[model samples]
Target chain A: MDSLGLYVLAAAVLFGVGVYGLIVSEHLMRKLFAINIMGNAIFILLVAASGPVEGAPDPVPQALVLTGIVIAVSATAFALALMVRLYQETGQATLSSRDEGDDG
Target chain B: MTAEALALIVFLPLLAACAAVAFPGRWLGWIVRIGLLPLPVLMLAPTLAVLDQNVIHLALAGHASPLGIEWRLDPLSLLMLWLNVGITVLISLHAGVSFRPDSDRGQRFWPLWLILFASMNALVLSADLFNLYVTLELVTLAAIGLIAVESKPAALRAGMRYLLLALMASLLYLLGVGLIYGQTGTLDLYLIAEQIEPGWLPVTAMALMIVGLLIKSAVFPLHAWLPAAHGNAPGPVSAILSAMVVKVSIYMIWRLWFWGAAGWDLATAANLMGLLGAAAIVYGSLAALVQDRLKMIVAYSTVAQLGYLMLLFPLASTLAFQAASYHLLSHGLAKAAMFLAAANILSSVGTDRLQRLAGVDQRRPLDVFALALGGVSILGLPPSGGFVAKWLFLEAAWHQQAWGWLVLVAAGGLLAAAYLFRVLGVICLHPRKRLNRRQHREIPNLASVAALILAVSAIAAGFFSAPVLSLISAGLPPGVTP
Candidate 1:
């Protein structure tokens, strides 16, 4: 009924969508998109929830969340490169721990 | 030095990262190398000086919090900041010599790495939750970008997996923040901690937030993406990812537990985390022992090392906190050295399989020694930082009369020793001809030196714990028994 309630609902939906995307997505890029969406939702919630301490959305949490988003992207890009190399080497996109023969 | 100097320490690298994109192909490597020049002397020294004093607050543009960016200097932040900058410089320099800039992959790596450093500093100095989040996001983006720098499909898949997990964590964290907002309407961690009551809503908030952080820290079950991401990446990238980036989330959890969510009913959650950490210790070490590839072993070892940080929660003493912080620094150096040593081996042998590295020590003694130093440090052997860290944790647990926690701490050290010695054994005993059959190429001196410096520091931490401990105790809350 209020702004907080609306934000909470939005966060729940965002979380659900992120989970669903993480489960169903096969391509790494699409998964990245889903993850970004999830991060955005979290950022929104953190800022919204801070609730304007002293007539301003608590700047501290907002700054932290912003830093988190950037870190997420950096890590994502690095992982994608690693994935591409893996595919280039082994000719597979999906992760499978199942190997035919044990090295040990 | 003004806050402007501290700001420059973080942003200069970021500016270089952007400038790296603008440079010509041949000059990018030199430009990146030059970019790191000011960091060691300019950024780290003053930070250490600041840490020796009290908390130094810098408001960007002379504006205070809630309206402008702020950089807060504390011992914990200083420790992390120095390590991040120092290691990034070393990694960048190592890459300059070993990495072939002509390769499209190498060109992109430098810029992203600088950005990652900037984000890491921002995260360290961040005073409040929202600021921490923003810097964390910057870190995630650049880290993800670096992972995909290899442009390999597997790396891409790993990146995506990591992204998905990170996203989920953020969302959960957000939900928790939302709940807290509904209850207290403040986001500044200290303020919220002061005003909030120990009710169901706050409890839910705490749980959600901790879980989100746990996912990022990759404690046990949530660590699904770490091995593939770190093990399969390019060598320098793996070093960065394993050595420091992952620790950022753990640091966040530290802030939350001790400062942010101080009075939550943590008995259940602490034990839960401790159990998961214990599982990680045994499972990750066992997993590492059986791994064929060199980097995979180190990657799994990271999972186990991460478990060490969680041990503090169960012990839950000021000494435990200090031990955790100490261990964090020790492990950062040791693991970075291990990864760098592994990279050197990979570059030389053109493969990182354990069996193939039997005679590697004969050819590259410096590298082998570097690896051995890292091994000893990580195993918590005497005179190494890891040993002191383990001792502190055990003492803290003993003081609490928590016998189980002591055993957990000891068991982790033993497991660490087992896996580390396994690698050492393989290095010493195997036939020289097998490794020597491939032509031996001399590793760049800078890489070896970088690894050695870290190894030495890990050992030095044991002797020099006094200053660091005192600095960490500068602004303690009342009743915290350090």
Candidate 2:
């Protein structure tokens, strides 16, 4: 396979790993990491999939990647803060152990 | 002039959000007012322009598509703009009461609220797929933040689950955007629609994006997070989340299916989507019937109400388009009213437990009235916006001679009626001893009045259907025959 095809395959593998981690890990922090990994995978695919324009990498995908990175980072930061707050409130960082009748 | 106005519609609330953060306390109220009050007046220019031109496209910063971002305003988008403005401004009245600007909760709530508002306006107007993803993220983040703003353990947990799912969904959507961009080399939705062939890659991309949107919109089987999140949020927050937040993703799905993928033969996939809608209507209503809490019922109703929109894909005609778009408007107003009313009831009566809410109508007549009025629309009764929309849906189905879809429409409305009447029966008909004066806390009239206005307008929407229906028909999607 060519180098571009190899990168696309790698991104796909990474995305699968991220989805696996997101499902298996109970910790909110781990889930956040999994989400970021998935985001990174998409970024790689975004940049890899677009062909070069006149021998230069496509500028639009690069710009899109940069924006995607900013969004992923901010979302991660917010998720981390939420996890901490959740831990403080419930004394548990995982969603599974919450009290069933506590919904109000 | 129209371009500047369009820009202002998005940026005004965003600017208010920044200003809200800088000056967090006493000035927040005035900031929100200044931010939102001019929106309707500003929307007039675009409204007129769309009416005259059928569709108006603005290339941001004077660069054309395939390079610069584009914003399109057609009848559907114009309707969305009006709904966002009307609902947000009215709901703000309730928020202003519940989350006082001088209070700490208000300080956090207003900024996120403004940001969500701006992002939604941008989302509806966006002509680029990547831009839609960004705006969807912004809307999701801001909305989840609002959900957890109260920091109740339940709200926080709900927010966390929603955040995780929303993040995953955005990534899926982004992957699809990447694939589409790779193939078409243009991010513009119209350009992609024009250039895309009915091939494996493009079909896969469309499937990925639609599934991502389905999750975001909380269609059946993907809607587990909705009840807790919408149920636990503060009154105004829940109102907006149910009314517009979820609807925006569905709107994106509509844009993609009818406009972006116009040329593709999606008959099988459309049937699959319709089946999901049928499932959601059945499952959501049945789940809602058993929910003990009032807010959860309303939240589940949102899940069910969203089903009507999916029917459009299968019915795929101008009538179906009109029906679905009209459903969006009516359901948005009704659902917001219901949430706001439920919030008031919960705050006043100290709980929304269906069993505990007996005789609530005696003390909080306005709120109960608002809730029932909103329920009338949800159940698609006459002289309500929902009734008009449901009639259109049935007519669309009848025209297509799709008996199963026609049955589903009828059954959905009946199921809606069943759950709605269940709530009304408990609140209005249950016998209870006279409550002690101390048992009920007095909520402000303004909160109840705000909900009443929304409910009344939902009913009012049925009266003004002709103009809106004609406008919707004026800009039908490419493949549909008007």
Candidate 3:
């Protein structure tokens, strides 16, 4: 296989690992990490999949990756804030520990 | 001239959001009015342009497609813009009372609300896939933030779950965008449609994007997070979430299937989507029937009503498109009314528990009436917008001779009626003698009036169907023979 195929395969593996971690980890912080990892995997694929223009790496995907990173970072920050607030309110960082009967 | 109007339609609210952060207290209320009130007036230019010329395209930053971003406005997007403006303005009246811009909670609410408004306008106008992703994220984050703004443990928990799911969904959508860009080297939706070849890679990309959108739109099995999130949110927040936020993602799926991937033979996938809609209708209504809380029932109803939009894919005709688009409008109005009324009842009676809400109709007659009026549309009874949409849907199904879908559409309406009447019976009929006047808090009359107006408009939509239906037919997707 060529170098591009190798990179795509690597990104796929990373995405799988992120999804696995997101499911298995109970802590909200861990889930945030898992989401960021998944985002990085997609960023890699986005950059790797696009072919070079005139032997120079295409700039459009790079620009898109930069925007994606900004969005992912802001979303992670917001999620972390929510997680901390949740922990403070419920005395637990994991979502599973909360009782299901609370309606509002 | 149209370009300036389009720019203002998106940027005005964004500018207000910035001002909202800086100017707190009394000035904030005036700022919101200034920011939003002119939006409908501004829409007139674009509406006329679209009416005259079927579709209008504006290339942002003066560069054409495959390079700079493009904004396209057709009948469908024009309709969405009007819905967003109309609903947001009316709901703001309720928010004006509940949040009270002079208060701290109101301060936290208005900025995010305006930002969500701007992002949705941007989302509908955008012709690029990546731009849509950005706007989608903006809408999701703003919505979840609004859900958790109250900081109740329940609201916080619900918002957290929704945030996590939404983030994952965005990543899936982004991955698909990446794959499509790799294949076609263009992020423009129309350009991609023209350039894409039918193959595994493009097909895989479409599937991933659709699944991600399905989760975002809360269709069937993917809808576990919806009831809690919408149920726990503040009244105005829940109204917008159910009315427009979820609908926008479904709109994206429509654009992808009917416009972006128009040439691809998605017959099997379309059938699968229709089956999911059927399941959502059955499961959501049954779940709603057993719900003990008023808001949860309304939230579950949102999940069920969302299923009707999915039926368009399998029917795949001009009539189906019209039905689904009309459903979006009517559901937006009706659901917003129901949520606002539910919020008022909860505030007045101190709880929305169905058992505790006995005799609430005596104290909050207008709110109860609003809830019932909205339910009329939801049940697809005659002379409501929902009836018009459902009639179109049945016609489309009969024309195509799809018996299974035809039966499901009919059954879905009956299920809707069953749950809606169950709520009405409990609230209106199950009366306790001599309710204590001291315990009931009186909500402002304006709040209740806002909900009633929305409910009345949902009914009025049925009467004014001629012009809207004509607009929808004029803008049918590229491949459809309208």
Q: Model-by-model lDDT, in order?
A: 0.76, 0.91, 0.92
Chain B TM-score, one value per candidate, order as shown: 0.94, 0.99, 0.99
TM-score of each: 0.88, 0.98, 0.98
Tens-digit lDDT track of model 3 for B328-402: 999999999999999999988878888788778888899999999999998899999999999999999999999
DockQ of 1: 0.33
Best first by lDDT, ranked: 3, 2, 1
Residue pairs in candidate 2 whose N, alpha carbon or C atoms collide under 3 angstroms = none
| Tens digits of lDDT, candidate 2, A36-65 | 999999998988776563587778898999
Weakest lDDT window of 10 consecutive positions for candidate 3 chain A: A95-104
Candidate 3, residue B330: lDDT = 98
B412, model 3: CA deviation in Å? Answer: 1.0
Least lDDT summed over 10 consecutive residues: which range in candidate 2 chain B?
B430-439
* TM-score of candidate 1 to 2 decimals: 0.88
Task: Give the residue spans of candidate 1 off by over 4 A.
Answer: A1-14, A25-104, B26-30, B44-53, B100-104, B431-436, B439-442, B475-479
**TM-score of predicted model 3?**
0.98
Off by over 4 Å in 2: A51-54, A100-103
| Backbone N/Cα/C clashes per model | 86, 0, 0
lDDT of 1 by residue, B1-482 (tens): 64666878887888888888888488886667666788777775556567556677777778765556666777777778877887777776667766656667677788888888888988988876666766776787688778767665556656656766776776677667666766775656667778787888888887888888888888998998898878767777888888889999888887778777777667787888888888888899889889888888998999998998888777777788778888888888888888888888877777778877887887777778888888888889999988888899889988989898789888877887888888888888865455665466767888877777777877888889887777666645334665
